[model samples]
Target: MLGAIVGDIIGSAYEFNNTKRKEFHLFTPKSKFTDDTVMTLAVARWLCGDKEHRKETLVRHMQELGRRYPTAGYGGSFMRWLHNPEPQPYNSYGNGSAMRVSPVAFYAHSLQEALGLAKISAEVTHNHPEGIKGAQAIASSIYLARHGATKREIKSYAEEQFHYDLSPQLDDIRPTYSYDMSCQNTVPQALLAFLEGANFEDVIRIAVSLGGDSDTIAAMAGSIAQAFYGIPQNLASYCYALLTPYLRTILNKFEESIGVLTPDPFDIERFIKAQNDDNTYQQALKEILQGHKTSHWIWYIFPQLKGLGHSTYSQYYGLADTDEARTFLANPCLNERLREITNALLIYKDRNIERLMGSSIDALKLKSSMTLFDAISPNDIFSKVLDVFYDGKKDRNTLQIISKTFNGHISNN
Candidate 1:
């Protein structure tokens, strides 16, 4: 599903200025996600949240997101449909149907379901048989590809089911192909691009090189390519950073709902277990655990949620890099939590542990803001009281005031 967005962004720069060769840059300063991505997310959100798959619900999400990103290169008909008080299908056969229909492939459980959902998604605006067929053909091809179907099987299925001529090779189609908006003209060429490519990026390059409706063609091909080869981690991360927070949230939620999770780069659970098994660490943990469970300590150390057996934080929070570590260190809850852990372990004076504590304390103090302190009070006022002990700079009166504040916060919690 995200491959569609990646392709859209990569091809956006070359859409109007067609490039008939595959060696061009994948992204330039002008590259950005287009209508293909916005509508793809809308369909994915619909599949994630709307169990009944009602057209009214689908229409609401599409219109709502479409209006939110009004200048995403929407066609005249779709733009009108977005503004309409009561829009109806325009019986159009634009490649928009296929461009936005990739989500259906990921959301559906079977090829039959993929075809059915693709039809429902398309008929909201593209009620034309060709439009709906174009969507179904793309969705079904993706479904087949992801479910271990060979390229031959996918080509045969698309040809037999949608009657698209999959016989033309890219070399035959590329030179003469020009700008085309019709699904029939675009869908088969896009599939041919996918059929010829060796990997996900290669498919997108092939589609873009066809010299017509570059973004949409690449989106359709990338959808299938992703299902077949999976997206490269670096490319996926790059594309993910381009989305707005709202769009990123929806994309993450939809992927989570579909069990398409980020791969864990490290064995965090094993690390935790190893730490737990160390007698020195375990003894220190027991003293400072303060009636709190190890789970609480775990949460403080690794703030990201668990997924598919590992921490998703490393992926979503950008925490795997040293540069990004500073961002997490600035997190108030994490800061306070780490402070509590380090403070508790302070008495042990284990050289390695104390060194880590010293560095963490330094970083926290450097990044600390009054807002972080203020935020920590409600969630963990106890940490505030301990700070006086750690600093040894608070006067007796300040200690008294902090103790009172801590007692009050404990009661509130």
Candidate 2:
């Protein structure tokens, strides 16, 4: 799956100290992987055993795995449930589902298969509806990336399926966005990062900077990014060199089982080789931008990209889409209720748009969003957008600079 170990380990130190800064020590004594890592490895190993038997033995093994990794930073209630001597789900709604669900997607080749394994993985501990939804959203994202989903399609899928509104305005979600132990908030927002990302690396940055349950959020976003971006050679090498040998070995074995011989030897050559099939989308994106630049929304939306095209830039510069011009519009006011918000997020996954133009995302808790308005195309967004300037004029100016910088990167690249 998508760098589950990397995600868990990276997030280990920052469960409470969520920050966008990338300068933190990766492996201090305080920096340790949590139950998320433990459970993910367990699932990866189990999938290497048998795919069809997933349902029959997943929960049994999960319970055992939880016991084996007892002090791996589990929730208090989860620990209590784990220690009960019998396997009874405490019915969690935590981000744990989103944390440890990469293998479900990796092992299952199809969407249906992926979701089935996701259901199994979730029910093992997080039997709540929200837990299942998070797992499914993350799992579906991984599966889609493997199938070659566009950035817009992936974000659209996640927002629709998980009820994420990727408005650059955190205020939309922040006032009600809390640290409660449920996958509903964490998974959806994490998906928001992945959906809006221009490439793989930014997915991690967006999730990391979004600031709630930072590690898992970044981890989940990173997983999908890896699936789509296929990991760069240099960064993958650094990640592998820093990872515990045991983890490196586990990943090697997992890759082997999936018919991939070299998993972590990512290098510039390998990245270039990997992109032998990438076509000229990056180039095309640059052409779209013209002169219109990216907004602050780009930072949280697109984290690790080098640039965009003028055409790509111009397309996204269009206004945000609103239903005011249409007759059959979605119910935006539904977000007044949490259930409506949650339900709207999940169902929206079905409308994976083929083309998205403009900066306008369907921020309302609606069931689906078709482009009524768009300020930019998907390829030009970036993470610098998370800066959160109070001055509206500066923010627009900043987005334009980012957009130009983005296009410049594509042209130069």
Candidate 3:
């Protein structure tokens, strides 16, 4: 999915200025994300929210995101379709259907599901058989690649199912290939690029070297290449930095919804149980806590606290005046962790636990927000600290005693 966006941005500058050779700068000042990137994200957003796969839901989100970027190089007919008060399929067979359909491959649980969702995504505007077929072919190929299917298996499936000529070599087709918008002309060529490339970068080069519809072609090829080779961190980061905040948020939400962004519970538990020595435990806990502040692991261990909530659990040693907690809370990392924890708890649906976690995080945020210049209320601080750090056995008298202890500690510090 990230590879498709990267390919679109890299190839955007070269779309009009055709190049038959693969040798060129991968990115330039003129490079930008195009309609391919926009529609890909739109599809992802729709999939994230629409678990039921409703056609109306897909249409609404697609149009909403599409309208947000009206000048992102959408074709004339498609642009009109986006703006129409009541849009309908134009029976078009443009490769737009395939370019935006990559996310379906990752979102679907099975090949059949991928094909079905791809068809639904395309038919909103591209009701043409070729357009729908193009989407299904790309999505199915990606589905196979993701599930560890060999190139031979993918080639055989694509050829037999969609009747695309998968036998053409890139060398054979490169010399005469020209700009093409038809799915039949474009989709097979894009697949051939993926079949022939050595890596993700090579796939993009092969698609662009064909000298036709560079961005969309590379986008389709890169979509498959991503599933096969996986995207490089530097390239993925660069492409992500180019996206607007809204798009980035949607992308993160989609990834988390699919469990790609969330840490595996088994892995977390394994790490926790693997510790032996105090130093090893402290270091491991720090690393895990640092990596996933919003993780349920924090809550899993929260009720068994000994000292400062974040520091005591993360580090074996504790600091006075809750300096470590204050420092972490002031940084963006803590805020992100808070959001992640809050979201997880909300999804977990345990009202009592959610309320405790939410209130603790909110109090910590508020405490961090207060400045030294502001009048500090002991009661408020005491209540918040007690709420967060209290173990099961602490009564109000014990809590108040601990609070006074904290108050004295703060005054002295």
Flag clash pairs in model 1.
none
lDDT of 1 by residue, 73-191 (tens): 89887899999999999999999999999998998998889999999999999999999999999999999998999999999998898898988778987889999999999999989
User: In lDDT terms, how accurate is model 3?
Assistant: 0.69
After superposing candidate 2 on the true structure, give the runs of residues whose Cα lies further than 4 Å from its correct spot.
Answer: 20-30, 54-56, 162-178, 241-246, 263-413
Give the 10-residue window scoring lowest on summed lDDT in candidate 3. 368-377
Worst 10 residues of 1 by lDDT: 404-413
lDDT for each residue of candidate 2 in 98-168, tens digit (9 for 90 to 100): 78899778878789988988888888778998888889988998999889887778778777776766555
Off by over 4 Å in 3: 262-413
The TM-score, computed over Cα atoms with residue i paired to residue i, of candidate 3 is: 0.65
lDDT of 1: 0.72
**Which is the winner by TM-score between candidate 2 and candidate 3?**
3
Q: Per-residue lDDT for 1-413 in model 3, tens only?
A: 87788888878878999888999877654577889988999899889888898878888887898787776888999998888888899999999999999999999999999999999999999999999999999999999999999999999999999999988798999899899999999999999999999999989998888888999999999999999999866466556545654676677787887777623211222223433234443442453334323323442222111132444232221111222223333445333443343333334232343244445663343233222101222343323333443322223322332353342221110
TM-score winner among the candidates? Answer: 1
lDDT of 2: 0.54
Superposed Cα deviation of residue 332, candidate 1 (Å): 13
